[model samples]
Target: MAFSSGSTGGPMANINVTPLVDVMLVLLIIFMMTAPMMSYPIDIDLPQRSLNPPQNLKDPPPPISLRIDASGQVYWNNSPTPISALRNMMETEVQRDVNNQPTLEIDVNEDADYGLLAKVLASAKNAQMQKIGFVKK
Candidate 1:
């Protein structure tokens, strides 16, 4: 706090901010000194290499293309496939290893039956197919 150097000295209307700025700078310095100590990263213990590594790590199987036409007819890889066979196909595909489960890409026409689409999705889920996907076209 400071008063004006005038003939009739009184309380100053404006505040002195130098002390406030000094205090803020001291607080900033204290935080800067302590921030690194507060943020020590948690250590991660990794598993040692297994004696038997994975065998025959070939590429994953190719994706299967499924298309549903406006008339509710299903096509498996561009060939006409009955809806009843979807389950058997899905089950056989899911027999692959988890990482090798082929992606089922389904393309549904705009006017396709929603019931058929739901049935297909339900079948995939029932078979525990991990990588069923829908195509835009």
Candidate 2:
């Protein structure tokens, strides 16, 4: 809030929200005042719980490390893998357990090729990978 003793008002460029805030406050007070006075009596009958055995929950599969080196070579779990096989690999991993697909965590070298990265992402997208993450270093 700015208050000036000297008046130099020549078509103010800054917006003054005092009136808007005052209106909003009045509306809020009105709503608050009226909200508690108009409550209608209603009954809610809650349902009883039925006895049943809880289903077993399966733990999620581990995340797979997908690394890319500066030379544009790809690695699946530290083993050399070709870019041509990326789509198939992603599909296989995803299909391994349909309910819970393993997340692919990419850890790439700083000098890794951007084109290869794009291709990898494209393959992942094509294979409909549910989760893909990036790992630092």
Candidate 3:
């Protein structure tokens, strides 16, 4: 005599919620697993300096560049100079700058003899050039 709602065959209504609950739980677990790996902690208190940067940051022109080639030959500022003469010249330069010491930059090629490079460095020292450095190229 009377009609009811959501009851297809009888007087009972049922809904299947297992699939929807499974999907929601799977998504929650995925997010939980990935949240910890997303970001890492970096602990450091970096110091800040108020000093002005130098004008020639890349490379500064040294007083002299002593180059030793593969053939056991040396050049003083792109000119041929014997080790003895180079030593003497450096000695003279050092003497001229009595108050402040001048620096020498030695540039040795990869194929250059190691012994020759050592000798050149020694000569620079003997000439009183204390601030000596090697060039990468």
Q: Choose the strongest candidate by TM-score.
A: 2
Q: Distance from true position, residue 1, model 1, in Å? A: 56
Candidate 1, superposed: residue stretches over 4 Å from native: 1-56
Q: In model 1, which residue pairs have backbone atoms overlapping below 3 Å?
A: none
Q: Residue 26 in candidate 2 has what lDDT?
A: 100
**Candidate 1 lDDT, 26-109, residue by residue in tens:** 999999999988997888666688999889787879999999999999999999989899999989888867667999999999
Clashes of 1: 0
Off by over 4 Å in 3: 1-62
- The model with the greater lDDT, 1 or 2, is 1
Q: Between the candidate structures 1 and 3, which one is better when assessed by TM-score? A: 1
* Reference-based lDDT, each prediction: 0.90, 0.88, 0.77
lDDT of 2 by residue, 14-45 (tens): 67899999999999999999999999988965
Candidate 2 RMSD to the correct structure: 11.3
